[model samples]
Structure formats: structure tokens, C-alpha cells
Target: MNILVSDFDGTLTEHDFFELVRRRWPLPPEQDPWNQYWAGEITHFEALARIFAGIRSRPGELEAMAEATGLDPNVGKAVQNLKDGGWEVVIASAGCGWYIERLLKNAGVAVKVHTNPGSIGSQGELLMTLPYKDKFFSDTTGVNKLAVVQDAMERAERVAFVGDGRPDLEPALLVPPQLRFAHGWLAQELEARGESFQPFQHWSEIAEILTRC
Candidate 1:
């Protein structure tokens, strides 16, 4: 079996949910919990929860922002193509599953997802929480990406790992250079480490290449 594990926010979509949130909220560096996250003062899950709890969305605004997060239109086709060629695709996200699930369902695709659980409050607060306790639970990311990828390696004859964020670095490194696909931050970090990987702008492009192989 061939397994393809992907990150949700920036890897599967054009924009990270934080990008959309920051655009609207625009917190000052001193006040933002993200600043502490970058400084190694807090965990990734806490940073996300802190940021989301502060966003006061009004009714449809959050959903609209999610729509604007720009899930690639080709996602369904990409998943279909990969599945046809014997790839079992899964999403591993450090971000909220609320919008991730929303986007996938909206795109008319069904892919198993491992991510942080989240919901909206009656007053429109974006409430997010760490995932249920598991062996793969992470102190930083709500989901342990490295563990997820490692498990895929254990189950499959071949595994492909793809991602585009800070949390993706270690897992991306775990895969063979040829089977790793990266973009943005992950790409830059891999290049700095003198690692080799296929860079991609869209998941469809990745699907195309993987199916051909």
C-alpha cells in the first residue's frame, strides 16, 4: 500500500487559517501569543487556542473567512487520482479540524483527518482544543506529525510526505528525499539543511507526480 500524508492549512490550501485571522485581527507583536510561540515560550497548540479564542467573529464571518482560505479547487480530483493509483491519502493538521473538515466537505472530498478539534461559541468565538489523548499526542502541535508519518511508514509499502510549515520539518525529514514534497517554510528549511525534496505549489501537482511514479 502507498500512503500519502499531507498537512492541512497551507499544504492542502492556498492560505493558513492564521493568515486569515491575523489579517483581520492584526495583533500587536507584544500582545500576540504567537510572538511567544516563536520565542519558544509556549506550545503550538496553546498558541493556536490563544489566537482563536481572541477572534470575535460575527455569525457568517468566520465561515466566510474559511471560504476565503482558498482550498484548491483541484483537491477532489487530486484525491481521486491518487486513490485510483493506490494511494491512501490522509490529512495531518496542527490546525483546527473545524475549518479543515468544512473545506474538505465543501470541496466534495472525503479524506481521513487527524487534527485539533474546534468549534464556534454562541457569541462567535472560535474555540479550539487539543485532541483526545493518544500515543501520538503532541505537547506542541495538537497532532504529532512525526508520529503520524512514522505510523504511515510502518503500514505502507511506500509513503509520501508533504507539508509547508514549521511543524512539518521533522516529519518531512523522516521521508526519503524523493518522496517528500515541500513549499514555503518547509522548502526553505530543507534547503538550508541541504536536504532534497520536490517543491510543489499545489496538491494536484503532487498527485500528478505521485500517480505517475
Candidate 2:
């Protein structure tokens, strides 16, 4: 059996949701932890924890923000087609589970999703919970995407990964070149690293690739 692991955010949607949040809730340059993460001074999860600390809103507001983000129109159909073709589809994301689930549910796509758990705190701060805290790398993204992909690999005859960001890097690298699909920033990164991947811009492209395999 073939297992398809896909990233959310820019991979499934047209824009990066984490970036959208950062933009919508701009922090002062001196206070932006994301800058540290970008500069390799901190872990990804630490950056996220810091970023979420600045966000003060209700769950509904966050949901609205997720809903407003545009998704690939063909995603739902593509997922269904993959399922029909006997593939087990899973969304492996570094983004917040609440937001990812809301976005997919709103889009009418049902699939197993793994991501950092998030919630609106009593004071309205967006709080995120990391699952595998002990396994975090120095770049700690909180979400153990490599472990997720590795687990999938153990369960399937073959595993394919589709993604478009920094969080997708390690997991994508775990898969063979032919079984990895990357685009946008991820594509650029892979190219710069001289790694091979199937570059894509739409879900149809991914669906086509998985169908053939």
C-alpha cells in the first residue's frame, strides 16, 4: 500500500498561514522571535511559542483567518481520488492542528492530520503544545514531521511526501527523490542543496504522480 504524506500551509493552500499570522500580528523588530529562528539563533518550536504568545484572539477569529486563506481548488478532489486509488492520505503539518483541521474541514476534505496542538488561552493568547519535546532538534519545530513520515513509511509498501516549506525539509529528505514532491520555497531549497524532487504547483500534479505509483 502507498501512503501519501502532505504538508499543509503553502503546500495545500496558496499562502503560508504561519506567515499570514506573523504579518497580521506584526511584532516590533526588537521583539520578533521569528527573526531569531530565521537567523538560526533559536529552534522552530521556540519561535512558534514566542509568536503565538503575541497573538491575542478568540478561536473564532483564528478560524476566520484560516478560512480566508485560499487553498488549491482541486485539493479536495485530488485527495478523494488518491483515496479511491487505494492510498492512505495523511496531512503532516508544523502548523497548528486547530487551524489545519478547521481549514480542511471547511474545504470538505477529510484526512488524518498531525500537527502542533494549539488553543486560545484564558487571556486569549494562542498557546501551542509540543508533543515530542524530547526529540526536538536545535531548530525545534515542535512537530516531529520526520517521525510522522517515518511511521508512515513503516506502515506502507511505499511512502510519498508532498510539501513546500522548511518544516517539510527533513521528512522530504527521508523519502526517495521520486517519492518526494516539492514546490515554492521548498523547491528552491532542494535545488540549492542539489537534492532531487518532483516539483509541483497543484494537487492534480501530486494526484497524478501517486496514481501512477
Candidate 3:
């Protein structure tokens, strides 16, 4: 099997949940868990959990905002193209799967996904939890990206990884440099490390490059 492992947040969508959540509920700097995360005082999972839990929106506001977020029109086509070429695509995300699943369903594509499970509280707070017993679960970030990629590599004849965040750096580096793809933070890091990788703007571009190989 040929595996395509990708990230779900900014890597797949035009915006990340943090960006949208912050736009709606910008916590004060002193109270922001993100500050703790950057300062090494908290875990990535704790940071996101606190951020979402801090939101006190009306019953349906958050849902509506999530539903209205736009995904690339070519995403479904890209998944199809990769599948047609015998690639098994899987998503590994440190973010909540609540909106990720909804967005993918709205896009009309189905593929394997692994992310932190979450639910919206009756009062509007989004509660996320780690998959405690999963093989790839992590206490620090909710999801251990490197484990996911390693699991895929165990079954795959060839593996390709794509991502765009700090959490993605390790896994992106685990894959062969030739099959690694990066954008945003991941891209800048890869460049600084002098690692060779494909830089892409859209999921469709990745599909084209992967299928051509």
C-alpha cells in the first residue's frame, strides 16, 4: 500500500480552528492558554482545550460559524485523484475532529481521519479529549503525529507526508525528504534545516505531484 498521511487543520482547510475561534472569542493576553503553550507552561492539548472551553457563545453560534467555513473546492477532486492512483489517504490532527468531520462531509469526500475527539457543551464551550487508549495517543499534544506516520509506514510500500504546523515538524522529517511536503511554518522550518521537500499551495497540487510519482 502507498500511504498519504496529512494534517487536518490549516493543512486541509483555508483556516484553522484556532483562527476562527480566536476571531470569535479573543481571550485576553494574560488569560490566554496559548501564551502558556508558547512559554512551555502547558501542553498543546491543554492550550486548545482551554481556549475552546473559554468560549461562552450562544447555543448555535459556534456551529453556524463552523458550518460556514469554506474548504478548497478542489479538495474532493484531489482525494479522488490520489485514490485513483492507489494511494490510501489518512488525516492525523492535533485539533478537534468535531468540525473537521463536519467540513469533510460537507465537501462530500470520505477518508480515514484521526483527531482529538470533541463535543460542544450545551452552553457553547467545545470540549476536547485525547484518545487515551489509542496506539498513537499522546499526553502532550493529544495526538502523536510521529506515531501515526510510523504506523502508516509499517503497512505502506511508500509514504508521503504533508503538513503546515509546529507539531508537524517531527513527522514531516521522519518521512523521506523526497516525499515530504510542507507549507507555512513547516515550510520555513524545512528550509532552515536545508531539507528538500515539495512546496504546494493547494491539496490538488499535492495530488498531482504524488500521482505523477
Candidate 4:
């Protein structure tokens, strides 16, 4: 069971899917505090709480947001290669599932997706967001991304992860040395740190590495 655990927004897709949601359901100027929040001015818990609160405040925003983001064409072929190689592929993302599902469907890849579910109310309000992400996958089944990769290693001899952002950095710290991390951010903060990562601007780099693996 060769395993590949990846992130959705920046890792697999060229766009930040969450931004699609905002575009569909434009927020009030007062609620436009996300930039300050994500820039480390506010804690993650606070940022998320405000983000959800804002979503709930605006009705029918989630569905419109989900429909706005597009998919990357290269993902389907890469996923097929992984599956053809007998690898268990999973998406470990903090983002919502609506966008991820649509993107994968467009990619024509039949694979397992692990992420938080997003629901839109009849009136177009975002009802709830589940915190399905975990810091590591060592203790559980392949639910938490790190745990999923750890679990996959039990069946496969090799494992690799691809992602971008600080959240993905958590997995980079915990994964085995044999496992590789492919960074997707154009300007990654971790690059300055001692963490080892293979920077990539596009999926072609990932395709090249997966072929070697």
C-alpha cells in the first residue's frame, strides 16, 4: 500500500479554494478582518471563529463559494498513477469538502477524500464546519492526515506527502525520513527553517518525483 497524503487548496489545486467561498458570498466591510487574522495578528481559533460567524451571518454563501473554484487538470493523471501503483491516496485538508469533491470529480480521479464536511442550509446559510483535521496520524486510523500516512505505512513500504502552508508543516515534522514533503507555496516560511522540503511551482514536479518513487 504505497501511500500519498496531500493537501487540497495549494498542494493539489492552483487556487485557494476558501477564497472561492468569499467571492460567492461577499462579506461586509466590518467582517473583512481575515487578512489581519491570517497574518498572525489573531490566533487560528479566533480567526476560524470569526470566519464561521461571518459565514453564518451571510445566507447562501457556501454553495456559491463552492461553485466558484476550478480544478487543476494534472491532478487526475497523478492520482491515477498513484492508484495504479497500488497506493492509498488521501486528501488531508483543513478546508471544506464541497470544493475538494468538485475538484477531484473534475480531475476524474477515483480516490478516498478525508476532510471536514461543509453544509449549506436551504436558505443558503453555512450551517456548520467540522474540525476533521488532526496534528498527526500516529494514534488513529487514516482519518487525521498524519495518522492516515502512518497507517498507510503499515501496508506500504513508501509514503510521500504534498502540501503548502504552516498547517502542512506539522506533518513535515512528524513523517518518517523515508517520507518526502513537496511544498507548494510560492513563498514558504518553512524554507528559511531547517525543515527539508522539495519546493514546487506546479504539479509537474510532483509527477516527476512520483515516477521515481
Candidate 5:
């Protein structure tokens, strides 16, 4: 069987959910952990932890806000189609598990999800945990997509990855050219690297491609 693993934030959804959270419940302007991560001064997990620490809202409120985020219109149907065709679909993301779950549930899509845990602590501080820390390769994003993809590769006859950002780059490289699907920024990265990949704008396109796999 073929396993299809995808990044949830920008690939499945119309917008980046993390960015949405930061925008809706922002930290102090002086605190710039994201820039630190971008500048290679901190790991992604450290950056996320710092950001979460600055959150004043409860988990439920954040989840509610996440539910308000939009997804690609065709994603739900495309996932169902892939499942109906006997392909296993999985969401491997660095985003919060609770947030990812809420968004998927709101969209009426059910699939296996692997992500970091996020919630509000008793002291009203934002709580986050890296469940897959032991499996981390290098960059500490908590949940490593490359590790997840590598494990999936061992079990499936074929493995395909769909993503749209920097986090997806290493995992995308692990998959063969035909099975790597890129969109948005990921496509640009692949083109710049001169790596082979299929470009897709919608999940329906991915579904169509997988049908013939």
C-alpha cells in the first residue's frame, strides 16, 4: 500500500495556522523568537516554546480560533478519495496537535495525525510538549517530519509527501521525485535545488496523481 504523508499548516490549509495564532493572540512586539529561528540562532521548538509562553489565552480559545481558519476546499474529499482507494493518509506536522485536531474535526476530515501537544497550563501559561523529541534528527521542531516520513517509508510499498514550506524540504528530498509533490514556497525551493517534483495547487490534483500510482 502507498502511504501519503502531508504537512498540515500551509499545504492542507489556506493559511499558516501558526501565523494565524500569532496574529490573533500576539506576543509582545519586542519578543521575536521566530526571527531567532529564521536567523539560525534557535531551534524551531525553542522558538515555538517561547511564543507559546507568551500566550495569555486558554487552549480552548486558541482552538476555537484555529477552527476559524480555512482549509483547501478540495482537501476533505481528496483525502476521502485516497482512503477509498486503499491509500493510507497521514498528517505529519510541526503545528500543535490540539490545533490540528480541532481544525481537522471542524472540516469533517478524519485521519491519523502526528504532532506536538499544546494546551493551557493551570497557571494560565501556554503549555507545549514535544512528543517526538527522541526521534529528532537535527533541527528541534519537536515533531520531525523527516523521521516520520522515514518510518512510513519502511512500511509502505510507496511513500508520497505533500508540503509547502521549509519544514518539508528535508522530508521531500527523501521521497523519490515522482512521489514528491510541492506547492507554494516548497515548489520554489525544489526548483531552486534543481530537484524533481510535481507541482500542485489543490488536493484534488494530488488525489488524481495518486490514483495512477
Candidate 6:
């Protein structure tokens, strides 16, 4: 079966989904740890965990923020079409799976999603449970984006990788020349090195290209 791998936050969604959370769900007065984490004082995992723990302290805020962000209208239809075409769609994102899963659930799009695990404390504080410096750089915010793609490629006959941010460049490069790369960034540094990359402003363009292929 054909396989389609995509990044979750910016690529599949309209914008950076987490930023919405940060904006809508500011930490309570006691939670200065999250602010320090964002300032680069602590590892991303630590910061993210603190953020989650802080948010969980509130009731129903996380779900509300998720509903506000919604999904990429264009990609939603495209993903459904891909599934109808017998393609196994998987999301390999650097962001936390906790939020992405809810977003996908809201979008009414069902697919295999691979991402870092997030936890909530007894007090409803959000914490990132994945340890950094492990096999996948557990402490990082954008963790192992490439490694997830490589794992997908290993299991599939042919794979198409799609992503938006600079973090995704590493994983997109791993696909064989024949595979497709649906990129959201207009110009990435990888172009200077003669890498095979394709720019896509919308998933509709990707749908067109995939249909031809």
C-alpha cells in the first residue's frame, strides 16, 4: 500500500497549533517555570512539561483551545482522499501527540499519529514525560522529526513526506529521489546544496501532484 507521512502542526494545521495554546492559556501566577523554559533557560521538554502541567491546572481550557485552532481545511479533505485512495496516512510530527491527537479528532480525520507523550500531574499540571538525550532527543521541542520519517520509509515501498518548518528538512532529505516532498516553506537553506525539494503552498497542489504520479 502507498504511504503518506505528514508533519502535524504547521503543515497539516493552518498555523502552529501550540502557539494558540500559549496565547490562549497563559500560565497561572505560580507557574513561572514555563516562561523560563521558553526563554531557553531549560530544555524544551522541561518547558513543555511545565506548560502542560500548568494548563492542566485549569478546567476544560485545553479542549477549548484545541477547538479554536481547528484544522487545515484544505489538508483535511486531502487526507480523506488519500485514505480513500488506499494510502496509509501517518502523522510524524515534532510537536506533542497530546494536542495533535485532539486536533485530528476534532478534524474528523483518523490516521496513525506518532509523536512524544505528554502527561498531567495529580494537580492537573501538564508535563512532558519523554526524557531528553535519549534515542530521539527526548528533551527537545521538535524531537526526532527525521527519525520518524526514516522509520516510515523502512516499512513502506514508496513514501511521500510533507512538512513546513526548517526542522522537517532533515527528514524530507531521507526519502529516495522518486518519493515526493510537499514543502510549505518558500525557500529553505537545503536548496543551496542541490537537494531534491518541491515547494507547496497548499495541500491542493500536493493532491494534484500525487494524482499525476
Q: Which candidate's TM-score is highest?
A: 1
Cα error, residue 2 of model 6, in Å, equals 2.2
Per-residue accuracy of model 5 over 99-155 as CA lDDT, tens digit each: 788777877889988888887777555677777444543447767889889999999
Model 4 TM-score is: 0.73
Question: Candidate 4 lDDT, tens digit per residue, 143-203?
Answer: 3665666666677777777777656665665565345555554225555665666667675
Instruction: List TM-scores for all candidates, in order.
Output: 0.97, 0.88, 0.95, 0.73, 0.87, 0.72
lDDT tens digits, residue span 39-67, model 1: 99998888889899888888899999999
Supply every candidate's count of residue pairs whose N, Cα or C atoms clash at under 3 angstroms. 0, 2, 0, 5, 0, 7
State the displacement of the C-alpha of residue 115, model 2, in Å, after optimal TM-score superposition.
0.8
Ranking by TM-score: 1, 3, 2, 5, 4, 6
Q: What ranking of all candidate models by lDDT puts the best one first? A: 1, 3, 2, 5, 6, 4
lDDT of 3: 0.87
Model 3 spans with C-alpha error above 4 angstroms: none
Each prediction's RMSD over C-alphas, in Å, is 1.0, 2.6, 1.3, 4.6, 2.6, 4.5
Q: Which pairs of residues clash in candidate 3, taking residues 3 or more apart in a chain or in different chains?
A: none
lDDT of prediction 5: 0.80
Question: Highest lDDT among the candidates is held by which one?
Answer: 1
TM-score, prediction 2: 0.88
lDDT of 2 by residue, 101-148 (tens): 877887799998777878778866778877554342223666677887
**Which residue pairs collide in model 2, if any?**
44-139, 45-140
